[model samples]
Target chain A: MLNHIWLALIVIGILTAAGRDIHEVSQNSYGNGIPWMLQIESPQTISVYGEAVETSLRVPRRQLQLHFHETAAADAVIPARVNLTHAREGVAVLDVTGDVPQQFKIMAEALGSGETLTARLRHRGSGWEAEFDPVSLVYLKKVTNAAFDIAGVAVQIAIGLIGIMALWLGVMKVAEKAGLITSLARIVRPITVRLFPDVPADHPAVGSMIMNISANMLGLGNAATPFGLKAMEELDELNTKKGVATDSMVTFLALNTSCITLIPATAIAVRAAAGSSDPAIIIGTSFLASLTATIFAVTISKLLARVKMFRWDRSEAE
Target chain B: MEIFRTFVSLLSAIAIPALILFFLVYAAFRRVKVYEVAVEGAKEGFDIAVRIIPYLVLMLVSIAIFRASGAMDVFIAIVRPLTDLVGIPAEVLPMAIMRPLSGSGSLGIMTETMQAYGTDSFIGVLVSTLFGSTETTFYVLAVYFGAVGIRNTRHALPTGLLADFIAFLAAVFFVGVLL
Candidate 1:
């Protein structure tokens, strides 16, 4: 299932990018090779040759409609700096800032110019004609860049976990050695017995699972991860079929993903940052929602385990 | 409600240090060599992290492609009608769909939604509640299963996704009740 889903994402992403690029080409989306007529509104007279002079470039709505073929295009006044080496030939850099069209911004970025777009300018009688580098296959370029960037970021995320993982795992090791984990498991036997019928009640896995779920409930994600991973390692020790997830693992994962919330800290923090009068307003709602999902998650995990395809006996590593 | 909020916040803040202190002190009292044993256990952390590199890279790269290609717009278009039938506001549909796939993507959507609609608005509350309630299913699956080298994750993905779906519905239902 994971193999298929993973393949489908890549296939769909590539196809969609190709389709969009083809559509853009057919529609002349970026007005490739088309020259734009713009009005220069600054620098009363061209005095400093080969020196950049701050200027304002006015793009008329009619010209916008002609170039991009969008009837709804509005007149845009862009702040720019121009370097004119001759009366007829010059270079203008348009600051791609507030209120600019989305297409134009993308074009600027695709052209490798971060926040400014450079265009070749020619003095045409009363106005200037500006020609921008053609942009094509933008979606494909974006998809390629994203894939490469995230691959490295994935390693960074894993490396970043080393310190935290070590800290929590070390603490958990001490707890286990001191016999604290065994007692913790004993305290939670009634619940663990039902949730994980396969694992023994006094097993250390139950202790780690309990700790994980508690950390998750309190929104301690960093702590939750190490404990959760520890639980997986312990549970794996009981697996008869190596390289396959047992029913207990599935149930634990289901519970973890939809664990009940005591405080939705990240949500409240974002709300507060966004200037909400009552940032913690979602606490009750989040708790209720997560509780409902967690109940269903556990039930679903148990039910699905009995199905023929997903039954533990039928699973084998490919 | 205020008291509960304060209590949980304080608990989460103190949880790590307190747990570390308690475990170390208890182990010391029990005559366990704390530093040596902890270092031995910490050694496994590096191996587990390094072992999961392949899984994490492939999983995150796929998700990044889907997001960058703007396939989500098409995906939302296809699912919009089904969601509409269930009384889900079209505005928060992106949040529901993105929540399971990518954490940062959904965070961006949540922030953007709140900025567009006031933070106190119904849509704003619903999106945040949705974000708060569910984990990033794919990420969790990758990291957790990846650590153990579990190749055949039987029933885990489907269960997690279904759980996330239920969480979205519950959020919508509860947020509706709240407003």
Candidate 2:
């Protein structure tokens, strides 16, 4: 299932990118090879042909409509620096900053530069004729960049986990050696017995699982991850069929993914940052919602375990 | 309600320090040689993290591709009608689809949604509730199973996805009640 889903994402992404690029090309979405007319507002008139001047260019509503093919395109004023090598021709660098059209911003990005687009300008009758660099295959370029970037980012995320993973795993080791984990498992035996019938009541896996779920409920996400990973390692020790997930693993994950919420700290923090009147307003709602999902998640995991396709005995782990 | 909120916030703040102190002190009292045992246990952390690299790289790369190509818009377009039939708000459809797939993507969607709508509006509250209620299923599946080198995840994916869906529905229902 994971193999199929993983393949589907890549195939869908590449195909969609190709399709959008083709559609944009057919529609001349970036207005390739088109010249735009603009009014230049320079503070001083340049007598020397090779002089550079700071100016503002005003793009008319009609030019915007003609280029973007959108009737709602409005007039825009852009700050620019122009260096004229000849009386009739110059290179104008338009600073693509605030209030710029979305298409222009995309075009600037596709040109592989920062927030500045360099365009060739010619002195027309009463205005400057500006021709921008062509932009095509925008979506495909984005998809390619994203794939390469995230591949490295994935390694960074894993490397970032080393310190925290070590800390919590070390602490958990002490708890296990002191017999604190077994005792913790004992206290939760009645619940663990039903949730994970395959494991012994006082097993260390149960202890780690309890610690994970408790940390998760308290919204201690940093602590929860190491304990959760520790729990997986302990659970793996009990697996008869290596490389395959056990019913107990699925049950634990189900519980983890939809664990009951007491604080919902991240959401509240985001709300507060967004200037919410009552950032913690969703606490009750999140709690009730997660509680309902947790109940259903456990039930679903148990029910699905009995299905023929997912039956533990039928699975052939590599 | 206010007091409960304060208590939970305080508890979360102190949980790790308290747990560490209790575990170390208790282990010391038990004559367990806490430092050596902890260092020994920490040894596995590097190996586990290295083992997860290949899995995490592939999983995150695929998700990034899907997001960057804007296939989610197409996916949401196809699923919108079915969701509308069930009375789920059209505006929050992106959040529902993204909640389980990517954490940062959903965070961006949540912030964008709240900015488009008022922060205290029903849609804003609903999206935030949805975000708070469920975990990022794909990420968790990759990291956890990858740690143990589990290749055949059996029923884990489906179970997590179904739970996320239920969480979304429950969020909508509860947020409605709250309003």
Candidates' chain A TM-scores: 0.96, 0.95
Poorly placed runs, candidate 2 (over 4 Å): A43-54, A86-88
CA lDDT of each prediction against the hidden true structure: 0.91, 0.92
> Total backbone clashes of model 2?
0
How high is the DockQ of candidate 1? 0.88
Q: In model 1, which regions exceed 4 Å deviation?
A: none
TM-score on 0 to 1 scale for chain A of candidate 2: 0.95
**Residue-by-residue lDDT tens digits, candidate 1, A1-318:** 888888999999999999999999999988899899988886575687988888878998887787677784478888888888866689988898767767778888788855889999998879989999999999999999999999999999999989988988887888889999999999999999999999999999999999999999999998898899999999999999989999999999999999999998899999999999999999999999999999999999999999999998888987
Docking class of 2: high
Q: Residue A156 deviation, candidate 1, in Å? A: 0.3
Instruction: Go through the candidates in order and give each one's DockQ.
Output: 0.88, 0.88
Q: Model 2: how large is the Cα RMSD against the reference?
A: 1.5
> Per-residue lDDT tens digits of candidate 2, residues B59-110?
9999999999999999988998998998988899999988898999999999
